[model samples]
Target chain A: MSSDILNQLKDVVLEFDIENAEAVAKKAVEAGVSPLKAAAALTGAIREVGDKFGKGEFFLPDLVCAAEVLKKALPVINSAIEKNGEKANKSLGKVIIGTVYGDVHSIGKGMVATLLYVAGFEVIDLGINVKGEDFLNAIKENNPDILAMSALLTTTAAEQKNVVEGLKKEGIRDNVKVIVGGSPINQEFADSIGADGYGATAPEGVKIAKKLLGIS
Target chain B: MQKGFKRKFEPIKILSSSQIEQIHSASLQVLEEVGFRYDSDKALKLLQSNGCAVDYETKIAKIPPDLIEESIIKTPSSFMVRSRDPEKSIRLGGNTLYFMNSAGARYCDVDTGIVTMPTLEQNNEGVIVSDALDTVNVFPSYTPYFEIKGVPPVMSCPVSCAQRMRFSTKPSRGAQPTDTFIWETQMAQAVDAQLMGCVEGAAPLSLAEDACNAAFYYLDAGFPIYIASGSIMGGSHPITVAGASVSHNAELLAIVVLLQCIRPGCGIIANNFVSAMNMATGDLNFGTVAVALHQMAYNQIWHSLYKIPINNTGSAFSNSKKIDYQTAAEKLPLAMCSALSGANLIVLHGGVTGELAYNPILAVIDDDVASTIGRIVEGFDINDATLDIDTIKEVGSTGTFLSTKQTRTLWKTEDYMPRVFDKTSYQEWLAGGQKTVIEKAKERMIDILANHKPRPLADEQDREINKILSEATKYYKKKGLI
Candidate 1:
C-alpha cells in the first residue's frame, strides 16, 4: 500500500500535474507512508526528469513544470513529516538571489532561482532592481548559505562589485559565498570583484551554487 | 533603393501538398474549436460583427474557416514601402528578396566583445554603417539597439525611430511597446516617409491590446502592417516542427482575419521567429536545424499556398556569446535555407549573442554572406550572347581567354567579388600581415564610418522631428511612463 502511494506521488511529478501533486502527497501521508520515502520518490522522479531533459527527450517547460509539481508536493510532505515529530530533508542549502540595482532584467535571475529550487536548494528571490543594502539586510535576516547577483546591463554590472564591497564592509564577507552572473559578467570580472564564482548560464549557476555549498 | 534578388528558379519545398493541407486544416480547426483571446474590446467587437463567435467576457474569438479563407484572399500579395528618398523604396512580395538589419539590445565592441548600453552616438554610427551597406535594403523595428543610454525606457522606441530617420533614409519598421507607434507615425510623416507598422501577437493564441491598437492606428495612417508571433518550441508552442507551424499559423491568421476585416486589400507580411528550446539549459536554441526546418516549411506554405509575403528571422541571432566560427556556422545554414525556400525579407546582419548584442564589424562581414546568397538566388542567364562558340573558335584550346573581350566585359558581372574575403596568395597574405576576416571587417567598418555619409535630413524636416520628439517626451511623462 505504501509503495502504491509512493508510486502515485512519483507519477504525479513525472506527469507534471501540479494540481494533483498536493492531493497525492496528502494521500501518501494518510496511507501511513513515511514522508521521507515519499520525498525520496519525488526527488528520484525529478532526477529522472532532469535526465530526460539532458537527453533531449523532455524540454525546458517540461522540466520547469515538473519542478513546480515537486515544489507543490514537497511542502505538504514536509508539513506531514513535522507533524510526525520528524525532520524533513527539504533543502540542500539556502540561497539569496536578485538582479542588482538599476537593472530591471529578471529573466536570468528568475531562471537561476527556479533551477536552484529544483536542485533541492531553498531559494529566496529578492526580485529585480535590488539594492546592496537590501542584499545586506536579507543576508542578515535569512542567513543564507550563498548570495547570487545578476546584472544584465553593463551600466548596472558595477552594482555587483558594490554589493560585494558592501558585504565586506558589513564584515559578513566570510560568512557567505558570493556568485555573480549576467551577459556582461565573466570570470575576470568575478575574480576582480572578489566573488567566489561566476556562471555564464542558469544551469551553470546552479552547479556553482552546489559547489560553493560543498554539496553534490 | 536596391533591386533585391529574384528567384529565377522554382523555390524549394519541404512539405508535401497533402501535408500542407493537413497543417492548414489543423490551424482552421484550432481557430474554430480552441479559439484565441483578443484583449482589446474593439477587436472583439470587430470580430463579432464580422461573423466570429466572440465571448466578450472571455475575449475569445472563434473564427470560421470561410472567414479565414476570405481574409487570406483579401490580403494583398505584394506592397510597396516608401522611403524618404524615393530611390530607396522596396516592394515586399513575390520573388524579390531584401535583407533587413537585425536588432540587439546592446552594442558589442569589435575587438573586446564587451557589451554595453549604447550611447546615441553609437546607435547613429550603426545606422550609418547599415545605410552604407548596399545589401541592407530595409531596417527592422528597433534596428541597432533596443535601448539607448540616457533615453527613458518608455521613449526608447520613438527615440530609436527618430534616430533611424535622422541617420538613414531607408524605410524603417515601427514598434508599439509603450504606445510609441503614435510618435513614430508622426516622425515618419514629418520626413515624408513610411514606417512598416508592427503588430505582434503573444504566444499560445492571444493578442494584447497594445498590438491591436497599433494595427488600427497604422492602418488609419495608410501604412502597411507586419504581423509576427514569436514563440519557443516546447514552451508556448508544440515541439514538433509541423505542430509549431500549425500553432504559429493560427496565431498569425487570427491577426490576418482581424486586419482584412477592418480594411480589405491591405498589405501584410507575416513574420516567423519561432525558435527551438534548449531543454537542458532552458534557453532558446537560436540558429538550429529545427528552426531552419520550421522556416523552410513556413516559407513554402506562405509563398505557395497562402500567396503571402513572408519574412524569416531564423538567422537573426546565434547562441554564441562572441562572433566566432560557431556564430557563422550556426547562422549561415538557416539564412541559406530561408533564401532558397523563398523568404521575402530576411533579418540577417549585426545580431549576436541571441539578440543581446550587436556589432557593426559583424554586419560588414555579413554583407559578403548576403551578397553570395543573393547571387545564388538570382541564378544565371542560360541564353548565351555568342553561344561562346565564336569566342571559343577565335581562341583555340591552347589560347588564353583571360584577355578576351568576353572576359573583360563580363568579369565584374559574371562573378561576385567579396569585399572582405581574402583572395591573395599565401606569400602575399603573409607579407600583408595575414589579416583574418574579423580584422578585415573592422578595417572596412572604419573606412565606411570615415567616408560613407548617409543623406542628411532637411532643416525643416529635422526641426519637425525634434518637435515631435519633444511632444512625445511630454506625452509619456504625462502618462507616467517617462
Candidate 2:
C-alpha cells in the first residue's frame, strides 16, 4: 500500500492532475503512507517534467500546469508530515518577487516565480503594483535568499531602484541579494540600481536565483 | 485588364453568431461599466453635452448603449477615395480589399536585411517600386521619415506626405492621428486626392485629446477617419484575447460616438491593430498564432455585426528583424488569415520586424503573397459557366482540353500566377543559376526601378504640392518641430 500510494502520487504530478494529486495525497496520509515519501515521489515526477520541458518536449502551459499539480498536493502532504512530527525536507531556497509600483504586469513576475518554485524554491509572490514598503516587509518577514523585481514600463523601472534604496534605509541591503529584470532592464540598469544580478528571461531568472542562494 | 487591377471578394467568417453576440455584449458592458478616458477637453465637453456621464476630473466618459449603437449605425458602410486619376480610384468597404505598401520605417535595407537609417535616395527608390508593384493598390498615410535626408526627422510626416502625393496617383492616407497630419491631408486633398488618416483610441475605453482632435480635423476637412486601437494585451489592456478585444471594441465604439456627435454621418472606418505583449520580453509581439487568431476574430466580429469594413495590420508585422524564413513563416499565416477573413484595407505590403524596417524585395514578395491571397479570397464563381457542365461532358473519357476555347478564355482569371515565385523544373532551375524567391524578387525590383515610371503629376499640381510642402516646413519650423 505504501509503495502503491507513493507511485500514485508521482503519477498525479506527471499527469498534471491537480485534483487527483490532492486526493491521492490525502489517501496516502489516511493509508499510513509517510507524507515525506509521497512528497519525494511527487518531486521526482516534477524534476522529470522539468527536464522534459528543458528538452523542449513540453511548453510553458505544460510546465505551469505540472507546477500547479505539485502546489496543490504539497499542503496535504506537508500537513500529514507535520502530524507525524517530521519535516518534509529543506527547500533549495526562498525568494520574494514582485512587479514594481505603477506597472500592473503580472505574467513575467508570475512566470519567474513559477519556474523558481518548480526548481524547489519557496516563492512569495507579491503580485502587481507592489510598493517598496511591501518589498521591505516581505524581506523582513520571509528573510528571503533573493529578492527579484520586475517592471515592464520605463517609467516604473525607477520603482526598482526605489525598492533597493528602501532596503538600504532599513540596513537590510546586505541581508538579501537583489535581482532586477523586465523588458527594458539591462545589465547596466541592474548595476545602476545596485542589483546583484539581472535576468533577461524566466529560465535565466531561476538560474540567477539559485546561483545567488548557492544552490546547485 | 490593367496591371494590378483592384477587385472585390467575399471574406471568410470563422466565428459563430452566438460568439459574435457574446463579444458584442461583452464590449457593450465594458463601455457602460468600465468607461475609457478621453484626454481631450473638446471631446469630453462634446460627449457631456450629448448626454454622456462624463467625469471631468478623470476625463472618463461612460457612454450609453443607445449612443454607441446609433454611431455604429451612422458610420458609412462604404466610401470611394478618388485618386488624381479617376481610373485609379477604389472603394474601401464591403467585400473590397486593397493591399497597400507598409509605411513608417526608419530604415530601408535589402542586401543584408539589417535595419539601419536609410538615405533619401533609397527611400525614394522604395516609393517608386511600390508605385510599380501590381499588388500594391494605394499609398499608406505614412512612410519612414528619418530615412529621407533634408527632411528633419520631426518633419517627416508632412514631408513624406508630399513625397507620396508626387510619387503615386493612388489615393493615400496620413500617418498621424493629430492636427499636424490634418494639414497634410488637407494638402493631399488640394492636390486632387482625398487622404484618409487614422485616429487611435487609448485602450481600456479611452480616447486621448490629440487623437480625438485629429479625427475631428480630418472630419472637418471632409476626409474619412479610421478609428484605430493599438491596444497591447497585458500592458494597456487585459491579458486575455477576448478581454483585450472587448477593450478595443469599447474604445472604438466610444470614438465612433464622439465622431457622430461632432459631425453626424461622418465617414468612419473600423480599424483594430490590437497585438499581445510578449511576456518573455515585454515587447509588443505581432507574429504569433494568438495575434493571427485575434485579427481573424476581430474581422469576423466587426464585419459580421457592425456591417463596417475591417482594416487590420495583416502580414505586415513580425518580430523577426530580417527577411528570412521566420519572416515568411510569420507573414504567410497572418496574411492568409487577414485575407480569408476579408479585411477591407490590409496594410503592410513589405514590412519586417514590427514594421521598423522596409525592403522593396520584401515588398515585391509581399505583392506576390497578397496576389495569391487575393485570388484565394476571390473564391471562384459557381454558376453554370464556371461549373462547366457542358465542357465537362464534351471532355469526358479523360480528354485533354489545354487548347480549348474555354481554357484559353478562363486561364487568366481562373488561376493565380505568382510573378516572383518560381515553378520551373529542377533541371531548368539549376541551369538558370538556382535563383531563390528573394533573389528573383530583387531582380524584379531592379527591373521595375530601371524601367517602370509612375504617371507623372501634372506640372501645375506639382507646383501646388511643392508650395504645400514649403508652407508646412515653415509652419513646423516655427513650432520647433523641425
Tell me each candidate's RMSD, in Å, in order.
30.0, 25.9
Residue-by-residue lDDT tens digits, candidate 2, A1-216: 789888888898777775576888888889998778888998889888888877867656566777878888989989988888998789888889999999998777877887888888888988889988989998999899899999999999999999999999999999999999888888889999899998877888888887887777
Q: In candidate 2, how many Å is residue B295 off?
A: 1.3
lDDT of 1 by residue, B1-482 (tens): 55899888889989999999999999999999989999899989999999999998899999999999999999888999999999999999999999989989999876677899999999999999999998999898787998899999888888889899999989999997878889999999999988898999999999999999998999888899999999999999999998999999999999999988778889999999999999999899998988999999999999999999999999999988888988899899999999999999999999988989998888999999999999999988766753577778876854435424465445566679799988754434665799998999899999999999889999999999999989999998899887
Give candidate 2 regions above 4 Å deviation: A1-216, B1-11, B144-147, B393-395
All models: lDDT? 0.89, 0.78
Report the alpha-carbon TM-score of model 1 versus the true structure.
0.69
For each prediction in turn, the share of the native Cα contacts (below 8 Å between chains A and B) that it retains comes to 0.00, 0.00
Shift in Å, residue B245, candidate 1:
0.6
lDDT of 2 by residue, B272-312 (tens): 67778889998888767777888888888778788777787
lDDT (C-alpha) at residue B473 in model 1 = 92
Q: Which sections of candidate 1 miss by over 4 Å?
A: A1-216
